[model samples]
Target: MENTNTLTEYLTERQKFVNDEITNLIKQMDAPLQLKDSMLYSMEAGGKRLRPILMMASCESYGGNYKSVMTIAVALEMIHTYSLIHDDLPAMDDDNFRRGKPTNHRKFDEATAILAGDGLLTHSFTVISEDNQLTSDQKVFLIQELANASGPTGMVAGQILDIEGEKVETSLEDLEEIHLLKTGQLIKFAIVSGAYIGGASTHQLESINDFAYYLGLIFQVQDDILDVSGDQELMGKPVGSDENNFKSTYPKLLGLEGAIEQKEKYVQKAKEALKSAGIKNSLLEELTDYLSNRDY
Candidate 1:
């Protein structure tokens, strides 16, 4: 009960901080009214703010001030939001709803939605590059990291693989590879970027990378579980869309019970990585469990 309360309070405070930072940053942008409005639309559409909060948590765990990493956190969220906007396009998943609200394309026109995504993606780099707190070297490192995570060899490649895999049966290893690129890359950026900003030692960074990798797999596995068994109202989107789209998933490869077991395995792996890293961050450990067990 005490652990639950502490986790709840920690997530609440950090989520509020991320949401406020994102809102303020978007508001300060000098852009067209319609574009700004479109951009803010998805930004305000509610979700867990997982990436930013994870970034901040990782930073705090490494003895760095959360405020120092705020810009990067916000940038990570912007990139994530942009991806969602694009993912909902007619040429993509073609979803009409997000976070219980009209998707960006549904709320606005397709062209506007595309531009909104473009604006957010470009502006994220500006936020990172222009931050005064980070040195130029750090800014370059972050830019490279984000590019590698989201560019052709990373999330985009994973997305292409997913689209292609929908046509045929994909091996479990292949599916894992696809998700590692599509989902895991950005997640890795969130954790590693924080450690980088916090000036972690080489050994600490390696352990943190291991933790992030396993945690990413756990995150995707839980998502697969939710898509099969989650409440639509709480999920803010239709469940079983993976089945509808004929996408390969962990639950499809492994049975539902098997998928749950797989998630637990990765959760344990993540915890072990943290232990090996000698990082005594209870919140980070709790977050891994919370993510695995989340209903939405």
Candidate 2:
């Protein structure tokens, strides 16, 4: 019971921290007239803020301060939200719903949505690049990390693979390859970027990277399961989406029980990585467990 109480408090506190930063970043944007409303529409929609939270969690886990990484973390979420907005556009996923409400294109016009997504994408780099404390070397790394994770060789490649996989029968290996890039890259960036910006030691970065790598894959596995089992009211999107779209998933590749087993294995791997670091981050450990078991 005490353990449960501790985990609950950690989650609530972390949520508060990221939630505040997200609001501030959106409010302070110097957006153009044509794109402002649509950009704000999705930015303020209140998704999980998982990436930014992971940045803080991982930074703190490595004995680094979370506050120092807040702006960069917010920048990560903005880039992620921008991708989702564009992915929902007619030319992409054509998703009409997000967070149980109208997507950007649904709330605003298509051109506006396009420009808004574009604005967010461009501005994400600007925010990180313009930060005064980040040395040119650090800023360069941040830009590279953000671009590679969200760009052609990373998430975009994964997305393209997903789109291509639709045209033909897919193998389990194919699905893993797609998601490793598609979802995992950005997540990996979130976990490690915090350490990079915090000036973590080389060994610390390696350990943190290992923890995040498995955490990221397991995170996606849980999502595939949630999209199958989660309530639309709770998930803010329809359930059984992977099945609905005929998209192959971990649950499909390895049965539901098998996928759970895989997720646990990765979670264990993540925990073990932290163990070698000889750190006591009860919050970070519990967060890994939460990601392993989360329903949405």
Candidate 3:
């Protein structure tokens, strides 16, 4: 495994690359100035860029050129950004800030924010369809994967479950199901789609899917922990939003200590999945540790 410094550098470089690519793609799109501005506002909001990074990493792991998958990675980020925009709407989380800046709705008008999200979502499909590097079959597969992950069966369903889950005392199992669909589905797509683009075998895709599943749970568990203990400055938002919003969380279902224990278990499971797949990816291994141990 690489040392901490090496891993940090690697992540930083890849994050910069993703950010630059996102900016370039947005500029290339021909849309109304205000709409493009709103989309750019949210897209430029600082984030860890984890999803796209994972996609590129998975592609490289399977000996596929990362550049070949760059369009897909960018589209994933656009979709994710659109979700965040809609998630912060008044009908949703009603968050005022994201990434330490005004949310899309807060930065612009609510209607503009909603439209910006719609624009980004539709533009993502155009991106995939227009990418010259991918064959028609590859494009179709990517579009299908993105649609499945973000549509009714995936993130949208998860969002509905989250909204409904907040109204009642939700069980641990139910909470897991909500997150698995809501948060885990797109994450699963990131890993699996990358592997697909890289031409991974069915067996390899299954293993990576398992690894992503555990990682998604760990990601949310850590978010729960951070909500209770994280610094607002580094977190880029107020802490305890979950409790304030009366949302169900692992730390709420299990005690804080128990939540930490659960995160650790998922971390181990993620690593074991990679091992079982006979894959050797230092970045992915370190990512598990880094995400679980993150302060923000």
Q: In terms of TM-score, which candidate is strongest?
A: 1
Q: Which candidate number has the best lDDT?
A: 1
Clash pairs (backbone) in predicted model 3: none
lDDT of 3 at 32: 89
Give per-residue CA lDDT, model 3, range 1-296, as digits (tens). 33336767878888898999999999987888999999999998988998998897787777777778888999999999999999999998888999899999999999999999999999999999999998999889899989999999999999999999999999989989998888888888888988898778889989999999998898888888999989999999989888886699999999899999988889989999988654645667777788789888
Tens digits of per-residue lDDT for model 1, 67-130:
8999998898888899999999999999999989999999999999999999999999999999
Rank list by TM-score: 1, 3, 2
The stretch of ten residues in a row with the least summed lDDT in candidate 3 is 1-10
Score candidate 1 by TM-score against the native. Answer: 0.97
Give every collision pair in model 1: none
Overall lDDT per candidate, in order of appearance: 0.89, 0.81, 0.88
Better of 1 and 2 by lDDT: 1
Model 2: colliding residue pairs: none
Give the CA lDDT, 0 to 100, for residue 163 in model 2.
84
